[model samples]
Target: MTTSTTPAVKSSEDIVGQKYDRCLADLLVKAGVGFGAGIVASVVLFRRRTWPVALATGFGAGAAYADCDRAFNPARIPGVRVLEKKD
Candidate 1:
């Protein structure tokens, strides 16, 4: 007798949850970096103004949102082809 091995399949909810977690992490990291950069810029070039910090943070968050959108919807990505499975 021979045994057949098959990989475990993840439910849709699990996949979505994982993606959400990843997006959240990315957003945090990017925003943190942007905040730091903004701090440096404010001290070095902006006369310690507060607007740069907010603007940079917003930019980072927007970028993260765009990246998350692309991740959730692959069709939005350019130059990508979606192929159907043939069985």
Candidate 2:
């Protein structure tokens, strides 16, 4: 009696779900940092304005989105080359 040797396969849904979770976590962390920075800048530099906080938070979210896009589509990243073997 020989034991079967087969690798477990992950479904596409699982892969997509994992990626989504990662991106969400990244967005939340980056945006939170930006918000904190904005609060400090607003208090010290902008006469306690609200726009700075909003702008900084937006920037953080945008950066996260860009990163997620690149992850989902590596070809969109600049200056990367893929070498193929000539058989």
Per lDDT, the best of the predicted structures is 1
- Estimate TM-scores for all models: 0.82, 0.81
Q: Model 2's lDDT to the true fold? A: 0.93
Task: Summarize candidate 2's per-residue lDDT along 5-78 as a digit string, tens digits.
Answer: 89889999999898999899999999999999999999999999999999999999999999999888887899
Q: For residues 1-87, what per-residue lDDT tens digits would candidate 1 score against the true structure? A: 988989779999999999999999999998998899899999999999999999899889999999999989999899989999999
Worst 10 residues of 1 by lDDT: 51-60
Off by over 4 Å in 2: 1-7, 81-87
Rate residue 1 of model 1 by lDDT. Answer: 100
Residue 51's lDDT in candidate 1: 92
